[model samples]
Target: MGEHAAVAAVDDPVTVDRIAANLRELGVEAGDTLLVHTSLSELGWVAGGPQAVVDALQRVVTADGTLVMPTHSTQYSDPSVWSNPPVPDDWIPQIRESMPPFRPELTPSRGMGAVAECFRDYPETVRSRHPLYSFAAWGADAESIVADHSFENAMGEASPLARVYDRDGSVLLLGADHASNTSLHLAEYRADLDTGRVTETAPVLRDDERTMVEWTDIEHDSGDFPQVGAAFEKAHPEAVRQDDVGTATAKLVDQPALVDFGAEWMSDHR
Candidate 1:
């Protein structure tokens, strides 16, 4: 092999390895349970995109340590259920392509349930039963929520999540408020918004599984109801359009985390 080829392969593996090691040093020991919300593109193109990231992470936090992320498929929500309007059908196919596969064993809750299928393995640990205010919402007024979504009463009886959130061992924030949360079952935490009394939706589901989940967050940290700096996509100028995630990846080592999942996560999220 040419000296250059040898150097490239050697260097690349080293980089991926270093990335993994760095995460370990970030207090991610074998027993540490981690719940991460990441933008893969933010990390630049590592050796293998999301797969590489997961592989590296798994290396540090082994069998005992659990890794979680949001695999939210908010777009998957049935159009009939949307409060504002439907995302154009033509755009959906494109949107799906951009979405990574929800590999729960590996990625856990990345994208906040943008990839719901990944968490199918651990349904009990990752779901909320409230017809509204149900998706991983904690410390909520259960009686009020249960009464509104009568079906919820049935689901909650079987729900292992309601009590978990009450204990504050849960991580209710998907990192995105109302509009972006794929964890909509928890929207019931807020009263008027919980009933569809605030915002109405009539979306249908495929079988009993929800093709779409409805959400109305009049009270959350998202601020200004439906306006955020990142929501409205700007028209990209011609030439080359680079997304920010790749840049984000390289920058992660230096940035302090917006959220950290310590031992308390289990106690809070459970």
Candidate 2:
């Protein structure tokens, strides 16, 4: 369903307390590390909006558990290949030269939604320095998870996704689908499949000054992620849990199991 349809699925008003209660019912425990992809609108109208959602998540997870969300600033991508709202041919060089460096404190996540943006802005949250695919995390292991995001391996074993996997994290699909499931990218990297690499450029801080840096990383493809998620649900039915949080249907899955299964699936399919 489209986002509008998901929003229309709920009619009742949702509050922080209601969301907290729903989270508990949805198998979100106090000490579980959760990487969440959310759509605030799908939960119906929230009392305090995204902040209330963040508050409710934090309340449920408490101070012990970690909360993470993608804070990718995709606009920092190479302008040469821009297609969506593509810029003029002559403007590419200007954009390449003038684009501001990615500052974890300053760059805003492009399409990550209001809740993720608010989470990234939280005082205690620590964000990775990856120019394009950075993630923001909060709570106990936030710093460790986001400490060193390798430029050469954006979502590979060196990235936060691997750390979350190693910690036995959970993937929370809050009114979102497999298309937004970033942990799968780690599986793509692990698979024996031969996806090509692409050279991308972004403005990053080097020696406390902004500099345009070019790097080559694996090209990502999510065309089969939906199928992969379906196969995972079928293969490990016990590990995949589903329930309603507010009006949105939420799914919680074991991150390790999903990635393991995804790696095998990608090897065959990709």
Candidate 3:
């Protein structure tokens, strides 16, 4: 019912296959560390459920490679802290049941949910810890990986993603564009590096998982969202000028159709 992907009112196997074929055409191959930020609802009824979607992607990037998706378990001790209003409040209990924190000891699973399962146990890679920055510095070129943007003046505390974009290395934007991309928070990270203001915090995770890490963020709300979005766009236009982007996932690349909301805004506002 929100901004996630879906299969029209009538299920479409044809669309799923198209998504599969599109992935193949995107140059997905073995051993490419990749990061994927997505909405499972986007690929309505993918064959074999979420695992099937993971399987198709895994096949493309096989052989000593890594595929990363954000298994973000920003579990709040208080439920009011949760975002993604699209998800039903009733679904939270089940969401808690279906997905847990990245269990380093457990083998990563695919299909358990769909997108999140693909990144099971892969949080350390996607959710990196930088004393000064927030957002996963995921990508082959660490120089390009950035994480520092945050909403200023908004919570008594901060979320893990509040610090990082959630990739192991290289970065990609699937459901949203680079404008929505959080990894580039790195652009602001450089500023924090010099200010000596970046600090660490511990955030509670779903299923009682806890992470101790350093992070920096601005605390503004919707007022900040607009500004943060602006800063990100100006900082990473190169990411938008391309069809494919590698992210911090286990060396994976998600080939998603790119949309430019920033451009639309300029046309309407400017």
Candidate 4:
């Protein structure tokens, strides 16, 4: 939505304090490890825009709590799988060979929205090493959550998703649905679904030079995530707390519970 339309959509500008208050009311607390997915535009007009949202989260979660966001750089992946405005096949080889290495301090998150992109620049925020499925984190548990991200099991047990699961984290969806809830991908790995592995390639920094690396990762799908999320929410209402923050609808979920329920749901339904 455009600025004017966004401003007109809400009665008051969404400020950091207001966002933080709403978050607290939605059950966010200090020292909680939280995974957040947000849509800035969905929050209507804001006084400080994306930064305000980030600040509000930080304010509520505090330094003792960890804040995490998916900072995936999908452009670094094999160009052969590009479907949103797919490139010509002739350009694939050139793209792969010339693609820049995944630099944790520099590479921007593709399609992860403005809030996450802004959060990436925050002081002391560290990102994982997974080329395509990296996650950015800040606060007390940042390093642990982002440590040792396995390239082959990007969203599986070796990934930050598992670390968050270990920490008993919460998932906050701000103007985003369960479809954008990446935690479910972790469940996919735990589920009975024998989703085969797919060969993937990414440019990485090795000995101060960019080189292409290949690995096999489990084939994960989100086609059924919405169904699984709906079923889980319906069956376990106490596990999810839904409310509104600014003009956008928000959901605070128990990450481990959601994953467990999602794994069971997928196993029985898929």
Most accurate candidate by TM-score = 4
lDDT, candidate 4, 1-270, per-residue tens:
789989999988989999999999999999999999999999999999999999999999999999999999998877788899899999998998788899998999999999999999999999999899999999999999999999887999999999999999999999999999999999999999868889998888989988778889888899988898898899989999998999999999999999999998889888
Judged by TM-score relative to the true structure, which candidate is superior, 1 or 4? 4
Write the residue-wise lDDT of candidate 1 on 1-270 in tens digits.
Answer: 233443443424434476566664444556444434444433433555445655665566564444444333343333444456667777655554453332213333323432123332332233332322223211123222222332222222233323323322222121223244221223223222322223322232335443433444332233322332112112111211222222232111100011111112212332
Ranking by lDDT: 4, 2, 3, 1
Q: Candidate 3 on 201-235: residue-level lDDT in tens? A: 43324356644333444431122324544443465
Which ten-residue region of model 2 has the weakest summed lDDT? 1-10
Question: Runs in model 4 with CA error above 4 Å?
Answer: none
TM values, all candidates: 0.41, 0.96, 0.46, 0.98
194, model 3: CA deviation in Å? 9.4
RMSD of 3: 10.2
Give the Cα lDDT of each candidate.
0.33, 0.91, 0.38, 0.93
TM-score for candidate 4, please give it: 0.98
Candidate 2 stretches with Cα past 4 Å from truth are 1-11
Model 2 lDDT, full chain set: 0.91
Residue pairs clashing, model 2? none
Tens digit of per-residue lDDT, candidate 2, span 1-270: 455665566676688999999999989999889999999877877778899999999999987999999999999988878789899999999998898889998899999999999999998999999999999999999999998898887999889999999999999999898988999999999999878999888889889998877778999998899999999999899989999888888999999999999999999988
- Model 3 is weakest, by summed lDDT over 10 consecutive residues, at 245-254
The C-alpha stretches of model 1 lying farther than 4 A from their native spots are 1-15, 76-221, 224-270
